[model samples]
Target: MNAILNSARAELLRLRKWPAVWVTLVAWLLLASLFGYVFNYVAYKTGGSNFASEELGNAQIFAALLPENLPAVLVQGMPMFGGALMMVLGAIAAGNGYAYGSWKTVYTQGPSRSAVTAGSLLALTLFVLGVLLATLALFATYTGLIAATEANTIVWPAFSEVAKSFGAGFLVLEMWMLAGYFLGTVARGPALSVGLGLVWTLVLEMLLRGVGGLLGPVETFTQVLPGTAAGSLVGAIASGDPSAMDTPGVLNVLSGPTAAVSVGIYLVVLALGTMLLIRRRDVA
Candidate 1:
């Protein structure tokens, strides 16, 4: 246990100084701000529409940007760009060790493979938690400003609502991150792992989903895919008229409970798979 803690501390310190980590986090924040507020605010002021606010009146668009809708805004992007970015972070973090021969050196330094891998996973989890909290704070600030500027009554979401959104977002992001870690472990390098992960997350899954609509077996398989589960989980929270919910990657293919369970399963499987692979395989 102490070994794992020490490894985690060391991994966190390393990740903190890595440029890729900062770039990914900042990219997500920028995306969240743009999609969550900037575009909507612009449309509201100009009496125009964007993907998310299409077919809605200016008043409805404006309302969606207020503090009350922060929960939905927070997680709406996770299944798409948010998840993809996190997967990249995980892939690079794990794969870079091999690219730079850091993993081999660490293995030679006396710690068990399990301890080192477990510590790395723990550090990644902490980073995911930090991103979620940072996003929450960023969104809160944006919504507060919007509310004050519009002279609207501030109605914060209920604690339960915020908690549910936070949980769902964490599950979705963590699942993707673990999936990336697994890929990085399997590939044993950052380049291939990052490339494959981004392709699967951003392209392959969507294509498969599209094809699934016409094929029963494919559709059944798609139901269990990480993207499907993540989308459904967000859909459950951001439920409304489907046509108006133009957020990409948000789906309603499964019930809320079912989607949550599927994501949880993926999270466990990916984490365990990554660790087992690291433990059994040669670092070199």
Candidate 2:
């Protein structure tokens, strides 16, 4: 237990000092703001229509940016860009150790490999939590300002709803991060791991999902993919009207419980797989 704690602390310190980690977090914030508030708010003010606001009236657009809808705004972007950035974070966090030969040094002199691996995973989980909290804070600030400016009541989302959204967002981000970590371990480097993970998340999954629409077996297989599960979970939380959803990756393929369970399974499998691979293989 002590070893794990110490290892976690060490990993956290390293991550804290890493520039790439902050850059990824900042990038996500910018994206969430641009899509969640900036565009919609602009369209509402100008009575103009964009992709997201095309179907939404000015009233609806303005309402979507209020504090009451913060939970939805928070997780809507997680299925796509949010997950991809997290994957990059995870890939680099694990793969960079090999690039710099730090893993070899640590494994040679540190506690058991299991302890070190557990520590690293713990640290990564903490980082994911931080990202969510930061995003929530940013969204609250934006919405609060908008509500005050518009003289609208600042109705907060229900505690239960916020908790549920937070949990779902955590699951989606952590799953992708762990997937990246597993890829990094398998590839033994960050470059290939990050590239392949991004392609899988951003492109390949979408392509397969598109083809799945035409083929029965392919559609069935895509139901279990990470992107599908993530999108479905977000879709379930967001409005149920599929036609109203203009977000790129949000889908309504599976039930909420089913998507949540699949995401949980992926999270567990990826974490365990990365640990097993690192423990059994040669770090040197």
Candidate 3:
């Protein structure tokens, strides 16, 4: 237990000091703001809702920043929310030692394989959760600043809705990190792991999903695919909000709670299976 805790602490420290981590977080914030700016800009110029007739570019910023719209915006942005970063870091966290032939050193030092792996997993969880929360805060803060700068204010969504959005985002983010963590551990190549993850997400799964949707019986099963559940959760959050998509109902195809539960179960199984594989493998 102590060994695992120590390992986790070390992982947290590395994550905190890592330049890539901070850089990605900052980039994500700016990306969200950029999206907000574009949305506000086009809307203001075209007589968008809640925009003054003569409102200029600055006031247009309030369109995406309005508290009522912020949650959905964050949720829908999950795909580009540094999922690849999580996977790459996930590879580094779980597989880097194996790449450099360093796992044998750690294994022989003291802790059992279980302790080391478990500790690292725990640490990765904390680090990623912090990133997700920070992402959420950055979005909310930037949005509020826009609203304030525009001399406009909007009531925040009900606490229940806000909580739901955050909770959903957290769950989905964890699942993606687990995908990265598992793939990194199994593939053990930083580039290969990341590339595989991107292709799996952007190509294979998408193709399957689109095909499933077009097929009668398979459409029902699409909700259980790799990226479908998370997409469903985001869809649930963005439901009824036109700003979330060019077509609002595109994400509303699956049941949010069902998808969430499925993804949770899938992650638990995947993590346990990876640990078992690690235990059986010879490290050197």
Candidate 4:
């Protein structure tokens, strides 16, 4: 237990030292802020209902955030954007230990490579959750400020929902880190692991979905695939309005339940893969 905690702490310290961490954190903030900015501007231009009133229940508050005629592209892509950045960040977090050759030191400090890997993954999980929370807080504060002077009420429950969505984001982030860790250990190439991790996350998943669409009943199978599942979970949480999608097509397929199942499968796959890799691999 002590070894695990120590290893997690050390991994956290090392993560803090990486420049990409700062960059990715800032990027997520900026993108979320951008979403708030555009929504606020549109609301200001049009006579939108004030969302600030506590009278407005959770559903009502949601209506205020997503006005009618909201573009589908932004709605579908916005939440995924944060997850995408997080996935990249997770990849870096998982692979960086190998890149810096710190896994050797971590293994030396712990009795086994498995313990060290678990500790490192634990630290990354905590870090991702913390970041997600901070992002939600900031988004709520900013959105409230935007709605305040302009007839928007601080919808507390809606903010809670946003926080929940952010938690979903953290789930995806953890999966990415775990997947990267397994790849890191198996491939023993930080560059390959990180590269493949991003590709599998950003590209391969999309391709699978597209190809699955062409084949009958393949979409169901694809949904259980790692990227699709993680992506769906985050997407469901971040979707503020139903009409946010302009063209209601495949992008509209994701629902909370579907995402939950997808993400669940991803967790199992990552866990089993990590354990299998750790058991077989020797610490350098």
List runs of model 1 lying over 4 Å from the truth: 241-244
Give stretches of model 4 more than 4 Å off: 39-79, 158-163, 234-240, 243-255
Taking the tens digit of each residue's C-alpha lDDT, what string does model 3 give over 1-284? 89899988977787788786677667766665555445554565465642222333434334545777777777766643455456666766666667876677888785888888888889878876787677677777766765676677557778788788888777776777788778877876566777887787667766776788679777766666757777777878877555554322125656878877876887797689778877888775
Error of model 1, residue 168, in angstroms: 0.5
lDDT of 2: 0.89
Alpha carbon deviation, residue 62, candidate 3 (Å): 6.4
List residue ranges in candidate 3 displaced over 4 A.
Answer: 36-64, 217-221, 246-250
RMSD of each: 1.3, 1.3, 4.4, 6.2
Residue by residue across 91-148, what tens digits does model 1's lDDT show? Answer: 9888889989999999888588889999999999999999999999999999999999
Per-residue C-alpha lDDT of model 2 across residues 1-284, encoded as one tens digit per residue: 99999999999999999999989999999998898888888888899977877777778888788888887888999999899999999899999999998888889998988999899999999999999999999999999999999999889989999899899999999999999988888887899999999999999999999999899999999999999999999988887332225788888899899999999999989988888898899887
Tell how far residue 278 is off in model 2, in angstroms.
Answer: 0.9
Report how far residue 52 has shifted in candidate 3, in Å: 22
Residues 100-130 of candidate 4: C-alpha lDDT, one tens digit per residue: 7766666666467666767777887887777
- Over the full model, what C-alpha lDDT does candidate 3 score relative to the true structure? 0.69
